[model samples]
Target: MKLRIISSALLMIAIVGAGCVSNKKFAQLQTTYNDLLNQNRALDSKYQIAQRDLSGATARVQSLEEQIASQRTGLAALQAALDKCLNSTSQGNTNISKLVDEINASNRYIQHLVNTKNKSDSLNMVLTNNLTRSLSREELRDVDVQVLKGVVYISLSDNMLYKSGSYEISPAAGETLGKIAKIIMDYKDYDVLIEGNTDNVPISQKNIRNNWDLSALRASSVVQALQNNYGVDPKRLTAGGRGEYNPIASNDSDAGKMKNRRTQIIITPKLDQFMELIEKAPEPTEGAAAADSTSGS
Candidate 1:
């Protein structure tokens, strides 16, 4: 009985020792597993930080590249401008002051021409309006006044100016001519042309030779009346005759023949002022050689 009790106690002690050793081994394995998990987590966090830093660095590099490219373009443009400035300086051999002066002079001359033309156009409008108002005083059945291509044309019926086959002015016609002279005297910058037209009829008079002589004498008589009687400038007067050739109406009927025989006064504005503007403008000098040539001359 004693030996069995002792064996049983030894077996129970061995079982307890084996169970404790197994529990210690299990605890050691669990600790090693936890340490490995912590190491893996730390490595993952470092990899994420490295990836974020790498992305930021890449973005910075791209921005720097773009900035560098823009700088290069600006440098290129500046270099091109410098090259152009140098080329212009060498080729033209002209200083900035001289070039500026020349440009200013050219601009002034062009502006002067524009101003002169505008003034001429305004004057023409005023003159045309005044003449129209003055000529409109006479009845349309007696006379006709019109403006064509900057010239004023005044046409009078044959009965208004002269008698049949005679170049002498009637008393009534002289009064009408005086009114016309007043209009002419208002404008001094115009030339006057007086023309007489006759119908296709054979005119045989004691003093007058033919239709040609009658037409010519009528035009001269009108011009003389304007100059001598009305005090119009003689230099502005011109006379012409169209006998049986230039007619406004056909001479087949008496009314048409009467219409064909008429007088025309044409007034044209003088353009001497425009020509003087051009002649008065300073011409451009060719080069610096102008001074040397002038001195030598």
Candidate 2:
């Protein structure tokens, strides 16, 4: 009987030990479950933040695209305006010689101002064996038609056509300018462009601060001469300033500086082959416009 009782006690001890092991496993499982729940909560929080960031990024991209579209529209309108201003007149004139002579006479005035000794064309006259027999150098300097790059260009290298610091053409220069106006009045088919350039010296005058302003004023002076004196239509003439930026010779030498410091009267035939080609150039893209918009400022 005692042995049997001892056996019963041993069985009870075994059952209690099994119960303790099972409870330990249950505690470990509970810990693992809590950890998994914490991990899931962290993942959900990160996903929410990511979603908000993505939404904000998408909205910004849309706004940028809309702005670009608006700029493209504005650029198109600007281009149209430029074209309307430039291409209004037809290209052709049956009577081109009379206009040609007036242009030559204006150049001659520039030559006379310089006192060109050699028939070397002080007026920078275009060498046309066909138009009129070559005038003597003195005569050529006194009066000659200059053809440059297939267009007539008069040089103002001899003296200051303008008073100090002002774009106003001198009264002496006006008589010659009157001749050019007569040509424009007669030749309704041709176009006129006046280009102004300046020497390399820095100008600090109160009226004209920089070379750009000086050059622009010079061009405007010529345009005014054409319009007021010659009665040429204002629409047909264009004025621009090169401001020592585009010099024909090195500015280091005195002679070169003189050449650079002058105005050019360019008379184009009505065909306008060159200007037509310029109009065909493509407009810039939105990105390019944005990059260049702040450049001058």
Candidate 3:
């Protein structure tokens, strides 16, 4: 019995020691696991911060690139404007000077003729002057002419040509239009433009509701009249409406608005050669743009 008790005591002690060692190893493993978890959490926080920073940087880069592109366009426009002003004539100095002298001389003669007409009679003189001539007859009863950029503009009031908000040409105005068309047909070298001007008053008609439409329709009506009567080519004509935007006189008074609101037939030299000079003056800069984009990238 005594020997059995002693063996039992020793066996219990050994078992207890083995159990303590196992508990110690389990504690050590738990502590290492906690440390690894803390390290992983810290790394994730740093990664989130880095991601935000990178996104912000990318947005800033995109904004800067957009501004650069806008600046490039502005620079190109300025360059083209400068080139136009410098080399518009495309002729030698001697030839350009000669043309300028002739134009100036013509202007003097035109002004002298214009000065002879009384202000009260100017309107009648313009209407009856028989185009290309400096003199006028009262029998035709025409309005005054204003010249600009080598084109002459004639003003006709609403009472003379149309009723309020209507595109239908009056019978008297039709006769006037026919006469104008006949003269224009005779002159082949001059390019003609018909522009419609309107007062600040709004349109109240059901057929046409807006000032823009009214202006456009009126201009088109006149153009069609000219074409039908004279067989004028469509290529030589352009119609535009300046609806209450370009009032020649004050709109505060009805009389002034009537003066301001008129269809003007502008007779000028062809702009094809001038436009060709403008179109042919510059390179597209496509390759440069591509290279710039690559560099930006």
- Name the top TM-score candidate: 1
Give the per-residue lDDT digits (tens) of candidate 3, residues 1-297: 434544555565466657776777656555555555555555554564356435544664465456445545655654454445357554332233333333344344334333322331344334434462532232123344444323456555656677777987877676667666766676566787888889989988887878877787888888888887668876777888888888867999986787777787876666773353221212334443443353356
Report the C-alpha displacement of residue 242, candidate 2, in angstroms: 0.6
- lDDT (Cα, 0-100) at 45 in candidate 3: 46
* Cα lDDT listed for each candidate: 0.68, 0.58, 0.59
Location of the lowest summed lDDT over 10 successive residues in candidate 2:
90-99
TM-score of candidate 1 versus the correct structure, residues matched by position: 0.49
Better of 1 and 2 by TM-score: 1
Colliding residue pairs in candidate 3: 127-142
TM-score of each: 0.49, 0.43, 0.46
Clashes of each: 0, 5, 1
How many pairs of residues in model 1 come into backbone collision? 0
What digit string (tens of lDDT, one per residue) describes model 2 on residues 1-297?
A: 434444555565466557776776656555555555555555554564356435544664465456445545654654454355355433212223333333344344434423322232322232433322423332223233454334565556425477655677777665555655665555466678888888888888887779999899889878877777667889889999989897967899986786677787777876666565222223344433442343224
- Backbone clash pairs for candidate 1 read none
The whole-model C-alpha lDDT of candidate 2 against the native structure comes to 0.58
Q: Order of all candidates by TM-score, from best down to worst?
A: 1, 3, 2
- Predicted structure with the largest lDDT when compared to the true one: 1
